[model samples]
Target: MNLVKRLKICVFTFALLFIGTAVNAQITNDITHEEAFTALLAAKKNAEDSNVLVNIAVVDAGANLKAFIRMDESYLGSIDVAIKKAKTARYFNMDTGKLGELTQPGGIIYNIELTNNGMVSFPGGLPIKNKDGKIIGAIGVSGGTIEQDRAIATVGAKSILE
Candidate 1:
């Protein structure tokens, strides 16, 4: 091959590689396990402080489970609820309680929970936002009253920034 042709091919290849990397970088910003663990630990501490046994779950921006913990004596049934709550928060980019309010009968999003393979549209789910205000993940807590769960989940979500 001619030297000029070879140089042109090399340039083309490099351009393609750079473009691919840039696209991938824009596609996602997943949460790190270390951050998820910190959030979970904060949630556990909050639950303990509140004298509540709870199940906590964290999900990435894609609504995939990243971390989970079931405190001692927590309701076994809360395991799935915690995960669903996290997924619901990440999927909607908002707190599940707000979603619940909208989904109530005669509300704007009535029966909306049915659309997401059964999202938990109650309190206890919160989106985890980064310093740049990007929703990178979410935290969910279950096995307590709605108020307690919401408080615990809020603590967990805020811990990501602390």
Candidate 2:
């Protein structure tokens, strides 16, 4: 490459890196262990009250697993689903149900779940938000019917709000 071209490329790369770092630094990861635990407990309780067995997963702002619980008699196959659902919620910063709607055939971004290392786009995933409406984490539940799972996850997500 010419000297001028190489210099321009280097400058462009540097600017991009600097901007990414600055933007990432501004995003606060306030999802502590306590918050994750609270979400898990709340979700578990909801499942119990509903007489549903379920697996629950919680993820921090970085989309890393923070907490998980598998209730007695929950389907073993649902463990991975729960974790992936939580990750899917955090990865897109939206409820997985919404993702499901968008990924449906004829909808925008159809088959998106094929990407992102295999996401679960169905219901049972929710973003945990603070009172200010900023998402701090996410929760996912599985093993129950779609409605039951979504309800349980919502209870979990709401418990730690703010």
Task: Specify the highest-lDDT model's number.
Answer: 1
Cα error, residue 48 of model 2, in Å, equals: 0.5
Tens digits of lDDT, candidate 1, 1-162:
999999999999999999999888642667889999999999999899989999999998888899999998999999999999999999999999999999999999999888778899999999998878999999999999999999999999999887
Give the local distance difference test score of model 1: 0.93
> What shift in Å separates residue 60 of candidate 1 from its native position after superposition?
0.5
Candidate 1 Cα errors over 4 Å, as ranges? 1-28
Q: What tens digits encode model 2's per-residue C-alpha lDDT throughout 9-128?
A: 999999999999988875575688998999999899989999999999999898889899999889999999999999999999888998999998999999999897999999999999
RMSD in angstroms, all models?
Answer: 4.4, 5.6
Off by over 4 Å in 2: 1-27
lDDT of each: 0.93, 0.92
Looking at model 2, residue 125 earns an lDDT score of: 92
